[model samples]
Target: MNKCVGTTEAASLLGISSRRLRQLLEKGRVRGAYKTGKFWIIPLFNHLPQITKGTRGPKGKWRTSRPPALAKINVNRNHIGSNIKKSPKDRKPVISVKRKGTNLYGNEVEILGPCKIVYQPDNPLDCGARLWIDLRSRYANETFSDIHFIGGSFPATR
Candidate 1:
């Protein structure tokens, strides 16, 4: 459906930052609307530039160019190795995310990660999560990719 999406919503939908989205609008690559004192809105057009979901936005202009092949890297999400039982005073599950990796541009990416939702009491399953490392390379041949959460019973909560 063609909906008039707000700047922030459009950015989230395209998986690009709001700043990047504004730049694209400024370049006239993707059409958008802005008032004197209001938020910019991107019209849902039929022929908008297709940015792959979760792929980082191009740095400068939106040109017709392909990206390079990114090397296949394996992401491992391990548990604490040792399960620690919470004392009677402390009552909370122990499952935290540990994310660390590099982007296509070799930028250091690290995050504390999100906490898992407890469906049942004290379910100590380490629900693995995958985060897409964004590359800051403006080159036309930089490998743009997304993180795929695999190997876990529960789906990774974004």
Candidate 2:
């Protein structure tokens, strides 16, 4: 199907921000779009033009890499330096867990522990982040989709 759409509509169809689409149009990057009467009309059924070299206009104004005045920020890395550190006489292996998201009942949920961020695909949409805890926990790698709500048989997990 062949169709011409306005800038914002084309951007929505392309899954990109409208301003970024306009920037592409202004830079002559969008393949099947043209400026007509001060408006860029984009053709449907065409791939969004790639951002090429020099498409971005003049460089942003120069600024210091760091703020002029700042306090010392302490970033704690827990498990990263495990090999280098000396251990106590005897200590238990602490199980650290981080969690997010509310139960099916719409209550707020939280978890406290050391933090390590990793990217994973198949994450659920239409909700907060999915939580992955120790394998033994009842809610390991649980998201809203995993909650079984058949006939209200089971109480919500908090």
| Clash count, candidate 2 | 0
Q: Top model by TM-score, which number? A: 2
Q: Which stretches of candidate 2 lie over 4 Å from their true place?
A: 46-158
lDDT of 2 by residue, 23-119 (tens): 7788776667788899887765432333334535684232212112111111113322452464552222222222243223211223232223333
lDDT of 2 at 100: 42
Model 1 residue 114 lDDT score: 24
TM-score of each: 0.28, 0.30
Winner by lDDT:
2
lDDT of 1 by residue, 20-106 (tens): 887666655564454345666566544233432333644544322433334232233222222245443343222222324332211
Model 1: runs farther than 4 Å from truth?
32-36, 46-158
Give RMSD to native, each candidate. Answer: 13.7, 16.4
Please give the CA lDDT of all the candidate structures.
0.40, 0.42
In candidate 1, the residue pairs with backbone N, CA or C atoms under 3 Å apart (3 or more residues apart, or in different chains) clash, namely none
